[model samples]
Target: MGEWRRCCDNAVCGDNAVCWKSDGVKLKLQGENIQPANENEDLKKGCYNYGVDIADAIVPEWKELWVQVEPEAECIWFGEQEASKKPNGWWSFTFRNYLGKSVIRIKLADGREVVTDPIEVVSPKTPLDEQCDPLFYPKFLRTLIDDLIRYLVSLPFDWEAPTEFATEERTQPPSPIFVLHVLAQHADTICYALQTIWRNPHRRLVTEERWVLLSEASSVDADTILMMLHYPEHLRPYRGNSLSTLAQRLKSKVPERVFERRVTETLDTPENRFIKRFMDIVLYWCDELKRLGYWEKAKSHQPKLEDLQNFVRFLRADPLFADVSELTIFPASSQVLQKRDGYRECLQIYRLLHIARAPIFDRLQDAIDNRRIDQLYEFWCFFRLAETLAAVLGDGQRPYFSTLESDEGGLRRDLSANLGNGYQLVYNEQFEPIWKPKARKKLSYSVPLRPDISLLQENRLLVVFDAKFRFDEKDIQPNQPLEDEMDKAQQEGEIERLAKHADICKMHTYRDALKCRASVILFPGTKGAFHCTNGTKKDNPCLLDIVQNNGLKGVGAVPFVPKPEK
Candidate 1:
C-alpha cells in the first residue's frame, strides 16, 4: 500500500498515473454505483460498479443480439449415438422444443453442460451480400446446426439397394444419397426450413432427397426417421402449421463420412453382401431376446388383435423404430413383422436382457439367429406398401394414402399467382359459356376460399383443393451466406395467409356449394400461428392465432416452391 499510491513521496498527487500499481486489480462490484479494487471476504466491503447508461439499452431488441454458445455435442450426418445406460441422478435431455435441433445427443461424460450468452452485434453487419459471406453466423444458422446434429445422432440401416422386387432385370440403381440444396442467402432459408418439417400432402411424391433434406434439417435422427417410415394410418392427412416453423428448429450435421453399401453389380446377382451384412448385424441383436425366454413368453396374455394394433401405433412416434422387430411371415392374426409395426415388439423384448453381465454384442447376435426377423425395426418397412394394398382391397380404407410429385402444383404457377394474379380467371376468347348461368336459385355471391383436402370417402363430398406457391428473392444461392430478412417477412406473412384462406373458404365457397357444408383452406402455418379459434369474434384475423396451440397437422394449402438451387 505504501509504494502503490506513492503519494507519500511528496504528499501530493502524482503528475503521471503511471505511478499507480503496475498490475491490473480485480474489481468487485458492490451495489449499482460502487466498484472496489479488492474484497476482504466481506460482502459489504465490495465496490459497486455502475453499468453503462447507453440509449435504449434496457429493452434491447433481440434481433440485434447474437447468441454466444459454447461448443455443443456434434455428430456425423446420419450416424447415431449408441444407446447406453445413463448416469444415475442425471435426467435425459427432453426433446420438447428441440424438434429442429439434433437428436443424437452425444453428451459430455458428466458435469458438462451448454450455456448461451449474448453478444452485441451491429444491425448493419447482420445483413448478407451476394458474395456469399463466408463466415457468417446467419440467424437460420441454427437450422443448419439442427439438421446436421440430428443426422449425426441417429443411426441408420438400409435394405437391398435397388430392392429385390424387380431382380430379374439388372439395371441402373437409383442413387441412394439424397442432397437438399437451399438458397445460400438467409431470407429464403427460413421458409425452406419450414417446408422441410411441415408435412405437406403427397410429401412422399416429392423426390426422396428433398424430403430427407427437410427431415434432416428438422433434427430428425435416423431412428426417428425409421419411425416416420412406419407411421400409422389416419382418416385425415395432417394440415396445420406451415413447413417453416419446423425448419427453424433443426441443425445441420457433418456429412456421412462412410458409406454402408457401395454397389456396382446388377440386382439379379446374389443378394448384395452389404445388405446381408447389415441383416446380420440386426439379427445378432435379436438372438439375445430369444435366449432370455422372450420367445417363450406366452401369447395367452396378449391377444393377436391388440398386439397388431399396438405395434402399428407404437412406432408412429418418429423418434423410435426400425423394421418390425421380427422377420416372420404371419397369418392376419400374426402377419409379417415387416408388414406392420412388429419391430416395436421386438425391441420391447430386449428389456429382458439388460443385465450388466450379458454382453450387448451377444444380444445383437441373438436378433439374427437362424436368419430370423430379430428384435429390430425391420418389420416397420412393411408400411410403405400399405397404399398399394389399399388400392387393391378397395375397402375405401387403407393404412396409408398419399400424393405424388404431380400433386404439388408447379413453382411457376405459385410465382405467377402470388407475384401477380388475384381470384379472377378470364378466358372469354375461347368457346365460353354461351350465356352466363342465370342468377338462379339463391340470391347470394361470396368470395371463394380454399377447400377440404382432409375429407374421408364416406362423406361423399368432392372438395377441390388448389395450392398456391410464393417465391422470394431470398432463395438465390450465393458462394457465401446472406442475410435472412425475407424469411422473417415470409413467416409473418404466411400466418396471415393461412387464416385468410381458411376464413374466406369456410364462410363462402364450401357453404355456397349447395349442401357442401365444410370448406377449409388447408394452408401452412408458423409454429405459434396454429392456435385454436375459441368461441371468439367472427372477424379475428389469423383465427388459428386466437386459441391455444394445437398444431397445423391437418391444414390444406397452396402451391409448393421448387427445390432450392443452392
Candidate 2:
C-alpha cells in the first residue's frame, strides 16, 4: 500500500561483503487482485506481498518480475544464478510463484553482495494474516509435528535402522537436521521437564564397605569380617587357602577393620545420571541451533536462548549433582527412568528426540521460513488423508515402507498405512510400467505415475488423490455467468489464467492409466465438489460423502485447507 522504500536494517549481507546498497534492485509486482503489501502488518520493512490469482488464487504459476538494478553494480544475482541485464537498464524474469517469502540479492563484481528486502508471495487461498501471523502458521506446523511424533512413537518403528538423508524428493518425511529444529520448537517443553525432574530427582541410598586401618576406622563391622571367616568348613577347602591366609595376615600386621557406610538419598543413581546426560545433549543442541541459525529464527517463540542456558546453569550449579559422574553409558536396565513420574516424562522427551534424529521428517525449516509452502502443503495433505482414513475406517497395522528413485535423481518414497475393513492408504506410491510387486493388481501402461495419495482395497488400487497447492476462483465461486457472456479475447485470457482443466486432465490420466475407480484433486479451498458417473446430481457432494457413501466412483476436487482445530 505504501511506496517502496529502502530498509537496510532488515536486509542481511555477508559478513565479509561490503554493504554498498541495500536496494540495488527495484522490483515491480505485476498481476491482478494484488493485495496491499502491508496487509500483514508484521511484515518486515523492505518486504512486499505479491498475490498470484487474478480472481482465484488457489494455484501458482509463473509470473513476470521486472527489475531495475543500480548502474554501479557490475553483476546481479536473483538467487544463485546471475541475472542477465537488458539494454534498457532493466532485467526481466519469470518466477514460479508460491505462497512463501523469498529474498533477492545483487552481487557486485567487487565481491560485495547487496541483499534487498524479502518478497512475501501469497497464494490466492492463503489469508495474509494467517501466512504472516506467528501464532497461525508456525503454531499449526508445530502442532502437526507434535502429532506426527506421537503417532510415530505409538507404532513399532525400527528407530535404529539405517536411513539415508532426504534428497530433493517431495515424498521423504524430513531431513535429519530437522530434528534440531523440532527440538528448538519444543524447547519450552524440554525446559519444563528438565526443571521438574531436577527439583525432585530420583535418588537411592548407597551402601558401601571400605577397609581402613584400625586407628582410622570410625566404626567397624565385625560381622562382615566374621562372615568372611565363617564360610562352611567343608566349602573352605575347595575355595582355596589364599583367602584364609590373607585374612590372618590382615589381622596381624595392618589390623584393618571393615567400615560399612550407609548413605541415604544419594543423587548418584543411574536415573539421575541419565538426567545429566540429557542436559549435556540439550547443551550440545543449543550450540548446534546457534550454528544452524535456528536460534535466530526461534527468537519469536518460547524457551528463549537465555532461558535454555539458565536452565542448564541451574542444573549444573546444584550441589546434588556434585557426586553424579558423567554418564558413560545409557542405563538400559534402569526401570525408574522408564516408569517413574518426572523421570518417565524426561524419558518420553528423550524418545521423541531420538525418533526425530532419523534422517526423515523432511524440510520443516523451509516451511517455517516460508521457503516452500507447496511442499509443506503436500506433506500436510498426506498426513491428513492418512488420519481421515484411519478414523473413518478402522485402525489397521503399522505403516510399511517402499523406496524408489525418481527420474529426476530424487528419492521416491512410498509409505502405506492400513485401514480396517481391507482398505489401505498409501503416499507417493508409483504406478510403474514394469512392476514385479507392490503395485498389487494395478500397473501403468506407459510411464510411471505417482499420485500424492492412493487408496487400495485388498491390495487393489481403488482411488487416487493428487494434492495441488493452488486453486482458481472460477471453480469455487457460485452463480457463474455463461462463457458466451464474455468476448472471445476475455474468455481466452481467463482460460490462460485458470488451471482447473489441466488439473482435471491429470486426474483423468491417473484414473485411466492406473485403472482406478476414481481420482480426486485436493487443494486449499473452501468448497469440495464431486462429478459422478450418474449425471443426475443436483448439487456437489461433500468430500466425506464421496469417501464414505459414493465409494469414490468419480473424479472431483476437495478443499483440504490447513487450519488448526479449535
Candidate 3:
C-alpha cells in the first residue's frame, strides 16, 4: 500500500484523499436503452466506445471527482445524489440529454488531460439494425441525407437573385453554391476517368501533307518528299530549266529540300474539350470547398478534395493538352464522351455533378459532418410525408409558399404545397392566418404552437403532425395500477422519467388547442397506429372512426421511415 501510494503521487486527490488514477470510464445506458445480446464484440472499444440512441441517458462512471472534463457539455449534469460523494467517496456524472457524435477531454486536478474516444448518439427509431451492429448508423445517416437532397430537389421552386426593386423576403437570392459532397462521392470514378483519358486520348488528323521549309523541318526523310508529290505546287518551287536537272537537284537537295508532313493532333478534339470542361468544374468545386470554410470544419474530407485538385492540375499541364484550347463549347452530345473508354467515365461524372447541385444541399454536409443524425431524420420525414400525401391526395397543383431566409441564427426554411384536391401541406409555419380568423377557423387561440407539419383542407385545419426522432414504449404504454412501494419510487423526482411522456401529452395539446381533426406524432419506430379518441381518458383503437364520422377528434402516433421505392 505504501509503494502504491508513492507511485500514484502524480494522481489527482481531494482533501485527505488517497491518490487514485482513473481506471477508464464506462457508460451505463438507461431509460429505454436497447441492448442486443448478440451485439458484435469487435465494436466494444475504439472511436465509438459506446452507442446510445438520442433518447437514452448514459451515466459516466469514473474513479474520482477531482478529474474534470473540458469544454463542459450542456447535456451532462449531476443529480442531487450524484453530485455528493457516494458512501465509497466516488464522484460521478451523467450524459442526460445529448445527441450527435462528441468526445470529451478528462482534465485531472493534477493538470493531466486525456481525450476520450468518440461517442455516437443516433436516433432511437433508426431503421438500421443497430442493436447488433452500431456500424450501420453511418450508412443509415448517408441514406437519410440522400433522401433529404432528393426531397429538396423535387420541390417546384425556382431561385432568382434578389434585385434592388425586389425585397429580400419576396425575392429569392441567387448565391454561388458548390456541392462538394457530390465531388467527394464520385472522387474515385473521376480520378479513374481522367487517368484513362490521359493514357489514350482521341486524336484527329488536322492537316494532310503540308509542306514546311527544310530549315524548319524536324528531320528530312524520303517519305516526306514522296508525300509532297500530291501537292504539285511544292514541286513547282524545286522545278529547274529541265526535268532531268530538276530530278537531279531534287535528289541531291533532298536533305535540304522542303519537307511535307501529315499531322495527327490531340488538341481541339471533342473528347479533349469535354475533359477540359470537366476539369474546370472539378477545380471550381475544389476551390469553393476551401473558400467556404468547409475544409476547416471537417478535415477528413480535405484530403479527397486536395487529391481531386492535384489530379486536375496534372491533367491541365499534361503534354497532350499543351495546345488544347479553353472550353468555349461543351461537347455534351458528342459520341466520344458517351462511347469512348476514358471519356465515358466523364459522362458518369456529369451525372453525379447534376445530382450534387441540388437545392439546399450546400448545408447538408455540415449536418452530416457534425453528426446531427436527428436533424437528418427530421428532413427525411418531412419530405417523405409530403410525397406520401401528394401520392394519396393527388399531385400538387402549385406551391402555396416557399421561402429560404437567412439571419443571425442561420437559415430558416419553410415550404407549402397545394395538393390540388383541396388539400395543402405546410412545414415549419405558424398556425394563424395573415388575416383575421373566421368563426370555427382552426388557429392557435393561446400561445402559438407551430407543429413541424400541418395539413389543411379547403383552408380549414385537417390535421397536424410533429416528427419526433425518439420513442419509448414505456412512455406510450397504457397506465397500470402500482403498489404503494412502486408509487413511492416514482415520486423520487426523476426528471428524465417525468419528461418521457411529454411528446404524447403535447399531441393532446395540438389536437385540443389547434382544433384540428387529428394530431399525430410521427416517429421512426415500430410503434404504429396508436389510436385514441380526442378528449377521452379511455384508449380507443380506431383513428378511422374519428375521421369517418367527420368529428373534430383524434390523437395517436404513427411510425414512419423513408424506405427506398420498389
Question: Whose lDDT is greatest here?
Answer: 2
How well does each candidate superpose onto the true structure, as a TM-score? Answer: 0.20, 0.58, 0.49
Q: TM-score winner among the candidates?
A: 2
Q: Per-residue lDDT tens digits of candidate 3, residues 186-254? A: 667788888988887888878556456656776546877566564445553344444456467555223
State each model's C-alpha RMSD to the native.
31.4, 11.4, 12.6
209 Cα displacement, candidate 3 (Å): 36
lDDT of 1 by residue, 234-349 (tens): 11233335643432332212222111222232221111222222233334322432343332222232243233323323323333212223323322132322222322233222
What candidate 3 gets wrong by more than 4 Å, as runs, is 1-93, 105-117, 122-143, 149-157, 160-279, 282-363, 396-401, 404-412, 432-442, 480-490, 530-552, 564-566
- Model 3: number of backbone collisions: 0
Candidate 1: segments with Cα more than 4 A from true spot: 1-275, 284-452, 456-516, 520-566
Q: Please provide, for model 2 over 479-544, each residue's C-alpha lDDT reduced to its tens digit, 9 standing for 90 to 100.
A: 434233233425665443345455666887887888888888887655567766666442445666
What is each predicted model's overall lDDT from 0 to 1?
0.23, 0.56, 0.53
Q: Cα lDDT of model 1 overall?
A: 0.23
lDDT ranking, high to low: 2, 3, 1
- TM-score for candidate 1, please give it: 0.20
